[model samples]
Target: MDNSSSSNITSSPTELDLDNLRAIKVLGKGAMGTVFLAHHASTDPSALSPFALKVVDKSLSFAADADRRARWEISVLSRFRLHDPLHPFLPSLLGSSETADILCWAVPYCPGGDLNVLRHRQNDSVFSPAVIRFYLAEIILALEHLHGLGIVYRDLKPENILIQQSGHVTLTDFDLSRSLTPKKTVDPLPVCSDPETDFVPSRTFTRFVCPRKKKSVTNQKGLRKAKSARVSPVSRRNPGSFYERSNSFVGTEEYVSPEVVRGDGHEFSVDWWALGVLCYEMLYGKTPFRGKNRKDTFKRILMMQPEFMGKPNALTDLIGKLLEKDPTRRLGYRRGASEIKEHEFFRGLRWDLLTEVVRPPFLPSKDETELTEEVKKGGIDIREYFDKLKAPSSPLWSPSLDEQRHNVSLTEF
Candidate 1:
């Protein structure tokens, strides 16, 4: 019931219906719902523009929770004026609607897919320094806008960063975001456990290498295997203030911050930590601290330092500061995006003229839509898809707010 939409959609600009959409294919599926690449059925069958449609089933066993999250995302998007563009990197809610058993919304289809997909296609499954700089600037501006609106984007993995037709990035999947009132008061007191103490004991803290990298290291003894950091963990004492701290634990496993991992109340600094992880992955082709399992991954996040390959530079230095275990000490911890934008890595970059850049690292052509023969003649009825769910299906997985892992996990698009 909390749904509203913008009429600025480039394709229709009018309230569309399930009847008007021909689902070309499933774009991706997430914890709460599935997204489809759909075009207006009334348009030329091979129209250049098609939007992404997200469909959520509100009749499942977890409908109450699903509906609440779906509505929350809708409300958040309602804040952005899509047509005029409050921030270019952020997405606009093109249109939305819900029925007695189904809830749905539309956003502009991102033809370039997600950052994760794009990263895999690169030469080393990684980006160059210039490319990383360009993308990070846009993503940083997006986070800045969201934080300015008092919204904490709990989820910040590469999968949620989508590339628009214009080659600029737009963040998607807001169901995991939390609305907080920015409290300028002093740092929050830690509860339950000190994240600093969550570090693995020195002797047992085996070298936590990113599973993807083949890089190796050795100590003075010339031993290459099973080496771990003796470096002191960053102090947990936060120097910066924050919005009201949230006790709710939610986020992607690899990107979750030290505070959230330790059950300490968290605030906006969590996003900064994730930005660090994002940068590390962009430069090195892998997340810095991924381990065998979620628990191990989180342990590495709380304990180990990121291993910077090759000679360290401004970019690596920026990543190190951002990945500081102490959220208070992290880059952009207090003053937000300004702290990040001023980093040496972004030097000489015109923050205001990002949109005017004629060539992005990658440009998705208008004909990027690779419609199959089935897609060309294609038809899938959304209403019929949900209507067919009269019988019980598998319960959709939702992340536990208590920080416990369920048997199921699904990402949001």
Candidate 2:
């Protein structure tokens, strides 16, 4: 064979360069992708370690805007690890590249797996109050980072929350997220010259007011120059409105914010809504608002009837504020995250002291390395591992109509 002019291909079949990396094993399979575990040989070879590399089929990028999505994901992940300065909690983006139609991005492997897995592995055992507070505090810190950068994390669930050995929680999956600047108000409402002539008493506001909280005033005159600075003066609704009524739905049915369910364009409040749902799940083993069908679930959300069974008063109060059907009355929006932190559940927590607090309440299984070793020695049985971590059965676990729509018929994928 003429070596230089040979038409022959390499003997190995597209094997990843295990020289700079090592022992690539499939972590999970998805519709269009698979994740792998490989050591970082590109860095200091002497360093003992490996990393998680998420690889996606390039053909999956055949859509018109696939490249744009890929680039956006890469951009977002690159900065994910450094979001929180004081108590930064995110996966470090090691490196990324493309070969053929495969897109590969690497991050530090989370040994403890995710919250979903933990919840399943330890069924019926609720996270300690300290752990819950720490995890939620980390979540809020992460949200503050993304929100500050104008990004909206539309998807918030246990599956997307990864727990590191250090007990820090990192939010993942940016597919449904987008940058949000306050939507510019359209056609400002005409300013009133004479209040008595132009003022029309708001019927909607009547039901929400507390007569005893204020004076015995029938028609509270002299409306302030700005009723609610947070709300747009030109929006169809007045300031301090709960949820803007509209008709559109975007988000997981169980976790979708009220405004989003109603089709009104959502704002930061949506994050708060999802956070409430997460908080509910944290305290209780399941979501507060759930139903046998999609329609039923929607009804429950509208009713905002989440049962507070066997819940601590502090925890119930937190959930109550979060699950408020009216967004305006929600916990965080009223007094900001401060109120949430101040709740009795988090009484002794010191935000400023987090930096000095070297360790977290939970840690990854110490046998993680042994598990990996077994995989290398024989073969990695990821399916069996995850099967053992399946979520517990609950009456609320029925697949909704929308869930059925996207449900995979077979488990092969």
**Per-candidate count of clashing residue pairs (backbone under 3 Å):** 0, 6
Model 1 / residue 284 / CA error / Å: 1.4
When summed lDDT is taken over every stretch of 10 residues in candidate 2, the lowest stretch is 1-10
Model 2, 1-413: lDDT tens digits are 01112111122123344335543465554332456666644553422466676655554433223344444555666555444443366555667766554455666777777776676666484665556776777787677667655566766777668876666677765645665544433232232122223232222311211122222233223222223444554443532233332222445667877666554566556777888898888777788777887677768888757787773587677777777776655665533454455445554344543433445655675665654564456433333322332446522223322232221111212
**TM-scores, one per candidate:** 0.77, 0.67
Best by lDDT: 1
The pairs that clash in candidate 2 are 20-41, 58-101, 246-262, 247-263, 248-262, 248-263
Clashes of 2: 6
Tens-place lDDT digits, model 1, residues 1-413: 12213211233234657677778776766667768788777774664577888888887777776667777787677677643656788877777776677777888888888888789899989998888888898898889888877778878878889998777899998877877765554332222122332333221111211122222234323421211221123223433234567777788788888988787878788899989999999888888888988778878988999998899898999999999998766777745787787566775555666776656777776654366554666657777765664545624333322233222123221
Per-model CA lDDT versus the true structure: 0.70, 0.55
Model 1 scores a TM of 0.77
List candidate 1 stretches off by more than 4 Å.
1-15, 43-46, 82-84, 185-240, 372-376, 387-413
Instruction: For model 1, give the 10-residue run with minimal summed lDDT.
Output: 202-211
Q: lDDT at 181 for candidate 1?
A: 62
Clashing pairs in 1: none
